[model samples]
Target: MDDDDDLTLNLFTPAIKKNVGKSLENVIWGNRQQRIKARKLLKLTARAKPTKTPTLSESQSDVYTEKSEIANNKKRKIADVSLDFDNNKRRNDGSGNVSSTPTKKLKDSLHFSSLFNSNPEIPTIDVKPVECIKEEVFSSDSFESLSLDTYMLRNLRETMKFNQMTHVQEQAIPPILNGSDALVKSQTGSGKTLAYAIPIIHALQAVRPKICRGDGVFAIVILPTRELALQSYEVFRALVKPYQWIVPGCTIGGEKRKAEKARVRKGINVLLGTPGRLADHVIHTKSLHLFKLRYLIIDEADRLFEMGFEKDVKLIIDCIKEKTLKKQTVLLSATLTNGVERLAGMSLESPVRIDVSQDETTCAVTPKIDLHINTRDNSNECSAFSVPDKLKQLFVVTPCKLRLVSLVALIADKCVLAFKKSKMIVFLSTQDSVEFLHKLFSNLFKENDSVSCMNALLSDQQQDIRKSKCLVTFYKLHGNMDQKDRTLTFTKFSTCKNGILLCTDIAARGLHLNNIQWIVQYTTPGDAKEYIHRVGRTARAGAQGNSLLFLMPSETEYVKTLSNMKINMKEIMMRNVLHNLLLLFEKLPKILENDRRPPRTYEEAATTLQIYIEKVVNDEPEMQEVAKKAFQSFVRCYSTYPKHLKSIFHIKYLHLGHLAKSFGLRDAPGGFSAGKNPIQSKKKHFYKQHPCLEIHNPKEYVKKPLSSFYEFASGH
Candidate 1:
C-alpha cells in the first residue's frame, strides 16, 4: 500500500459515518426527548401543589381569558401525570424514607397519556374547543344565539344559505326586537317576512304563558291578497315552532269559513289573513278579541289601496282598536302612492321609516328596455300607423269565427323554431276572442306544432293540465282573481319559455315577460296608454322583439295620431286579405246590412263588383291622398274627445264606430253605460237641459288614512 493513499482513507472513513449517524438521530428524536422531560417535570409540580384553596383574582372573574382557561385545563392533566411520576421516583430514592401516607395498590384505572393526549386517535378524552368560540358580546348577539328552542337549525341553514338577508330584514330585525315600530318600503322578494317574523317570535317568547285571553295575539299580519297571506302563514308557522306551543293560522277567501273559525277558536298566537276575511271573522265571531292585539302588520300596502280595499282595511283596523292595548304596527310596500301613504300615516304613529331603494345587494335591478321608433316610407301622415301591422282589415267580409281560425293558422305557419326559439304572445281584445283563438291554436299545434294557452276563464284543473302538458300555459289572470295569485302567475309567466301568453291589459303595465319575441295586438288597444303597454311586452329585459298591430281601413286616423308618438313598427299587409275579405262578405251580406235590403242576382252582382273594384284600383293615388286627409281629421277630433268618450271608444275606432262593429269590436265593461234608468230616461227634457250628467267626486270623498307604527291602534 502507498503511504499517501492510506492516510487519505484513514481521515475520511469512521469520522464521516459517525457525523452522518449523529445528524439523523438529532433530526428524528431530538424534540421527542424534550417533550418527555417536560412531561415528567409537569407531573412532579402537580404532585407538590395543593388543590383545596387555589386563589382567584377580581380580573379573572371579571373577564374570562383564553390563557386562564387553558391553564386550568392543563392543571387537571398535570395532576394525573404527576401521581405516576412521584410513585416511581420515591421507589428509587436512596433514603429509606417510610411515608406516613399508606400507599394504595396502583391499578391502571386510567392512562395518563390517554387523558392528556393531544392526538384524538390515541384514546384521549374528547374535550370540545369551547374556549375557541367567542362568547356572545352584544345584546343582539345574545338574542340571536338563543336557540330556536323547538325549531330546527337545519331550516335556517336551508333558507339563508341560498338567499342572503334582504335590506329590510337587516334593518328591521334589530328595531323590532327592541320593541320599536317600523315602516318598510321595499319591493317584492325583499325579505319582509323575516323582518317581522323574527322580532315577532322574540316578543312572543318574552310574553309566553302569560298571554291574556282577550289579550288576543302578540302578532297579527294582514295582506292584500290571499296567496300572500298563506305564504306569510307558512313562514310564521316554521318560525313559531321555536316558541313551543304557540300556533299560527291563516284566514282567506276560497277556504271554508267554518274551518277557519275552528282554527282560530283553538287560540292562535299569530293570525295572517286578507283584510276582508279577517274583518268578517272579527265582526261575526265571538272568540276573537281585537282588544288584545299587540302587533299589526299590513303587507302590500300599495296594492291594498289599488284593489279598492282601503275601506275594508281601515274598518278592520278600527275594529282592532283598544285603549291600554298599546300596539306596534308595521306597514310594508313597494310603491307608496298618494292614497296608500295617506293610509299608512293614519294608521302608524311616527314609525321609523326605512326605504331601501338604492340597495343593489338585495333588490334586483332590471336592465333598460330599448326604445326603437320606426318611420314608414312614402307617408306624410303619422299616427297609430306606426303599428299598422297589428291591425286587421276593417269590415270583415268573412265571419268573425272563420277570420279567427285563419289568423291562428297564419301565425302557426309563420312560426319558425330554432335552438332558442322565441315565443309569441297574442293580445286578444276580449275573453271570447281568447277562448276562440286558444282552441284554434291548440288544435293547430296539436296536429303539427307545440302551443299553450293562458286566460282567466279556464278551470283550475284545466289550468294545471295546460301548465304541465303544454309548454304554453293558458290562464285567465285578471285584477279580480286576488292579488297574491296575480303576482305568482305573472312571476311564473316571466320565466317560462317558448310560451304564447295571451293576456289582456293585466299583463301589460308593470308586469314583465322577458323572452317574448313577437307581440301581436289581436286588436288595437283602447287608448294610447293601452297601446304603449301592449307593445311594451316585446323588447323586455334588454331584448329585441317585434310588435304587430291589427288595424281596420277606417282606423287610419287613430293610427296616424299614434304614429306621431314615434313608435317603431312596419306595415305587414296580409297578401291574401282581399281574397279572405271576399270569402267573408260572400256569407255576411245579411248581417252586414242588418236587414234583407237587397239581394243582387249573382251574375249581375259579380259584374258590378268587378267594375267597382277596377275603379278603386285605378284611383289608388286619389284614395291614398283622401285616406291621409281623413286620418288628420281623426287625430284632431280624437285629441279633443271628452275623457269619458275616449275611455269608451277605443283609439283604433276613432271615427269608425260602424267600421269597428263590422270588424267585431270588443268593448271594455267598466266605464260606459248606454242604458239609463227608467226615471232618468223619462225626463228627456232634464237630460237635454243638464247637458249630460257629469260624474262628480263627492264632498265626503274622504281620502284614506294611512297606518303608521307610531299611531297604530292608539288613535282609533
Candidate 2:
C-alpha cells in the first residue's frame, strides 16, 4: 500500500475511532485512580508499624488501656497517630513512637465525646410551702357608700355601670380616700384599677376650686405598655364624663408627638401614659405642669421593673417630687416582688399596705380551693398567689413534630366545633412565631367557597350559619408591631365575640379582655412566675375560664416544676386531641379535600393534618421563608432561658429536625453548629482601616461626595 493510503486506513480503523473519543474517559479514569491511590495511602499509614520497639512505662500502659477501653465502649476508632503530618517530626527521637500534637489529641477526645458535654445539671427549686389566704367576699357596699363626689357616683353608676365594690376596692379605696400613700397587692381582674381610679377622681373633684383643663396635670398614671396606658386613659375618660371640668389625656410612644405636645400646652387635668413617654414629657414639654400633680399612680409596678423601665420611672418620680410636695404615690401590682418594695421605699412615704388577697373577710368569702400557694421569701408580699376560683388549668404532652397540628386541633375544638361562642389567646415564645402562625392560620381559616359550603352543611338555620361564618377570627399582637397597629389589634380583639389572639408575652401582663374563654400557652414561658400571669388573663373579675399549656416530651418535667410551685394542672394525651380533630374534619370535607378517605385512627389524622400543612408551606415560598425565620428565632429564644431553667430547657436536648417539622419544614436548616450558643453568637467586627471604602449610603454609593470620603479616610 502507498504511505497516504496506510495513514487513511489507520484513521478509519475501529480501534483508532474508539481512541478518538477516549480523552474524556481518560480524565474521569485518572480521577478515580487518584482517589484509589489516596485510599491506599491512608490504609498503609493506618497499618504502618514502628521501626523500633520502645519500652512502655507503667503509666503509659495504664493510659493506653484506658484509651482502648474508651474506644471499645464508644465504638469509635482511635485516631491513628502515624497518619498525622506532625507525627514524623515527633518520631525523630531514637524511640520510634508516634506522638500527636495537643490540638490533635483534643480534637480526637472531642470527637469521641457527646456534642453537649457541658450541659448544666438540673437545678432543684426550693419551693416554700405558702399558707393559703382566704378569698375575700365582694362587699355589698355600692358606689354611694364610698363617699365619692355626687358627679363621680353618677358617672360610676350610670355611665361606667360599676356599682358593687370588689374586695380590693373595699380595702384599698378607704385608705387612699383618707389621703395616705398606699401600696395595694391583689390578683389581676380584681378591680384594682377602679380601686385607685375612684379615689383619685374623688380627690381631684374635691379640690376647693373645681379643676379645669387649664389647671395642667393633676393625676399621673404610669403603666408598663402603651396598650395598658391607653386602656387606663379610656377608663379615666369614661369616669370623668359627668365631671366635665376634669379632662383626661393620654400620651404614649406611638402617637403623634405634635398632638401630645398640643394637649399638654392646652393643659390636661389627668394624665395617663407609659414610663418612657411620661418621662419624655416631663423632660421636654414645658407646658406639662406637675406642680399641682396630686396623685402619682404606678400600676403594674413589678412589670415596670421587669420591662427595664426602672430608670424612666425613677426619672418621672424625681421630677414629680421636685415639682410637688403634697403628692400621694400609689403602687399596684398582682404579685409583690422585692422590686416593688424598693420602688415603694423610693417613691412612697409611710404607705398603707392594703392586701385584700390576704384579708380575712376576703378569704372567708371564697374557700381556698384554687390558690397557687407558691410564695417567695418576702414576708411583706402575699403568702399565696391565687388564680381565679373558676379557672380550669390543663396541659398536653405532645411531640415536637405534632405541636402545630395539635394546636390547630385544640383551637378548632374550642372555637369552631363547640356550641358556645369562644375567645382564645395563643401565646408563643417569639414575635416571629406569633406573626407567622397568625398569617398561616388566617389563610387556613379564611372565608372561601369551601368554608361557605361547609358552613351550610353544618347548620341549616340562618342564625346558626351566620354564627359559624363569623366564628374564628384571628388577630396577632406583638412588641414589634407599630403602636397604632397594636392599639387597633387590641380594640378589634377585645370587641371580637369569638376570636383567637396570637401574641407573645406582651399580652400576658396587665391587659384585660372580656369573656376570654381560653388561654393557650403554645410555648411555655421561660420563667415559671410568668405562667401565673399568663393564666391570669382569663377568669378575670370572678368569671369562668380555662387555660391549656403545650409541652414537649423533653419539657414534661416542667409540670413537676410548676406543681412544686403550687400551680395545679392536668395532662391530656396528644392522641385524644388528634382523634377529636379527626372527628371535626370528618364533618368538614372541604377543609381537607385532598384526603378523601376518612382517617380511621388518630395516627392517620395526625399524618394527614401534617401533610396538609406541609403542602401549604411548600407551595408558598413566602410561607417557607417565614417558617425558617420563626424556627430560628424560636431556637434563639429557647437558648435564653433563665439559668435555673437551663437544665430543663437545654437547647442541646431539642430535636431541631422534629421541631422544624412543627413549623412545616421538611428538614432543619443548617448553620447551627453543635455546642454553639445561638443567643450568644459571635458578632461580625468591622475594621475602620478602609473607612472611605465602607458604603454608608447604599442607595447612593456612586454619588458619595469626594470631600466626605477624604474626611472619613482622614479619621474626621
TM-score, per-candidate, Cα-based: 0.43, 0.72
Error of 1 at 665 (Å): 8.2
Model 2 bad stretches (over 4 Å): 1-134, 360-383, 447-471, 586-596, 672-716
Tens digits of per-residue lDDT for model 1, 127-245 = 22121111111112322343333333344555423223445566667666666666676533345677787778767766746563344555678776554565577777777554556
Model 1 residue 625 CA deviation in Å = 38
Model 2 agreement with the true structure over 449-505: per-residue lDDT tens digits = 343555556645754545445337889988778877888999999987889999887
Worst lDDT window (10 residues) for model 2? 707-716
What RMSD value applies to candidate 2?
A: 16.2
Task: Name model 1 segments beyond 4 Å from true.
Answer: 1-154, 159-163, 205-207, 210-216, 237-244, 358-441, 448-471, 479-716
Which candidate leads in TM-score? 2
Using lDDT, give the best candidate's number: 2
Model 2 TM-score relative to the real fold: 0.72
